[model samples]
Target: MSRTAHVNRTTGETSVDVHLDLDPDTVTVDVSTGVGFYDHMLHQLGKHGGFGLSVRTEGDLHIDAHHTLEDTAIALGSAFAEALGDKRGVVRFADATVPLDEALSRAVVDLSGRPYCVHDEPLEMADTIGGDYPTSMTRHVLESFAHHARICLHVSVLRASNPGQKPDAHHIVESQFKALARALRAATRREGDEIPSTKGVI
Candidate 1:
């Protein structure tokens, strides 16, 4: 199916639009915004999800990545919700645990007509959980994405092998996305092309 989705904010702060098709083989993402960090995160999400994405943002990034990230999730999630149509013949559940040297994380999804996010992941940098790096904001984005996408999501960091493990924030984020991607790919599949739920539907 084909779909289009959008998200608009009140602060005149953030706005995003997403166009997506689940069956595309080569996902193309063209995104530009004032926030570099957010751009990286979006790339990770798209790449890991095996999704081709294209985004353009005009936000007040002098403040931070908050608006950009959250808005992007809103749009992307809405697109997924729109595209799923009736959630027919889908696997509906998947799980993945990803490791970045000392840091490891797990994410599970249920496209079962509801949205939720649980993050039990570990972070090596204070930048991840605190500072402007807002872990809560990231979680908010995840929750918004899943909720609107009509999917249940759970993310956990089962281990962080060492604090001295990796010095780069990019590595930390990349590993997390990689893990998420693997899990999402599995969940989106049509197992035996069967409807995974006992209700005879997704």
Candidate 2:
């Protein structure tokens, strides 16, 4: 079966489109959301997760990036869930830890057909990155993605502080995204022709 899906979502605040291919012949990532940092993050996610992802979003950015990022994440998650289908032969669960400079983060994922999220970030991290992307939106994006994807996701920033330097929000956030991508790459792998859950479904 071809594992691919496309989603289009439009609201008063934003219009978003996402395409996902889980078993793509070649990885391709294209994202344009008006939020530069977020675009880079999503690129990392698609590239590291071994998936083909394309996203285009337009939002009322004069107000803020909240709607754009949230809606894009929702669309991406929806497409992912659709592409995954019944979860047959899926690896279903995985975890990964990644580090960027002084920052270290970990992500755990379970494609359990249930939505839950636990995200922890460093308190000392900067308030913003790339001038416009609010650091607080990181958790919101993950939560929205997990809910729409019907998956359990846990992301934590294990270390982001240096002895003399303040925490870098960019590094912390990038590490988290990379870790999440690796975990998702593993969790979404096909192992055999059987459902991973004991109930014979996921």
Candidate 3:
């Protein structure tokens, strides 16, 4: 069976459409979000997650990436949750750790039927992330993604004390994406080539 999902979301302020494909050996992505930063992040997510993804977002960046970012995350999460359908043949758990210079982060995910987030990063850059979008905004975007994905997500920054480590925002975010992607990749892998549930139905 083909494993893929397509999602579309629109509001008065923005519109988003996304596609996802789960496969161990292939990854394809076509991301076009009005928010350049967001587009880059999604691209990294697809590359790191070991999946094929295509996404497009048209949001009121003229105001801010708030709605656009949150909505995009929600749509992508919804697509991920839907694509896993029944969670059959799914490993259902993933984890990864990555670093960019002095900045290191780790992320864990459980494609469980639950939505939870554990974010423990500082607020030093709450207003500016790599001089792009606000770190707080990224945090909220992550929350929105987790809320819609229906998965347990935990992110921890191991080195948040280096005052001078304003690490490349794009690189920092991409590293996080890579870690999340690896974890998701592992969790979604089929073990023993069998469905990972005892219910024999997912």
lDDT of 3 by residue, 1-202 (tens): 5678899998998889998998735678899877666777788788878889999889997787688888989999999888877777677877889887667789999887779988766555446543446556667777888888888898877764367565455455656767777888888886655656565653
Model 1 TM-score relative to the real fold: 0.81
Write the residue-wise lDDT of candidate 2 on 1-202 in tens digits.
8999999999999999899999989999999999999999999999999999999999999999999989999998899899999999999999999999999999999999999999999777678899889999999999999999999999999998788888988999999999999999999999998999899888
Model 3: residues with Cα > 4 Å off, grouped in runs = 129-132, 161-171, 192-202
Mark the regions of model 1 whose C-alpha exceeds 4 Å error after superposition: 1-11, 128-136, 163-169, 192-194
TM-score of 3: 0.88
What value of lDDT does candidate 3 attain over all alpha carbons?
Answer: 0.77
Residue pairs with clashing backbones, model 2: none
Clashes per prediction? 9, 0, 2
In model 1, which residue pairs have backbone atoms overlapping below 3 Å?
Answer: 27-52, 28-52, 29-53, 30-54, 102-160, 102-161, 106-156, 120-157, 121-157
For candidate 2, report its TM-score.
Answer: 0.98
Top candidate by lDDT: 2
- TM-score for each model: 0.81, 0.98, 0.88
User: Could you give the candidate ranking by TM-score, starting with the highest?
Assistant: 2, 3, 1
Worst 10 residues of 2 by lDDT: 122-131
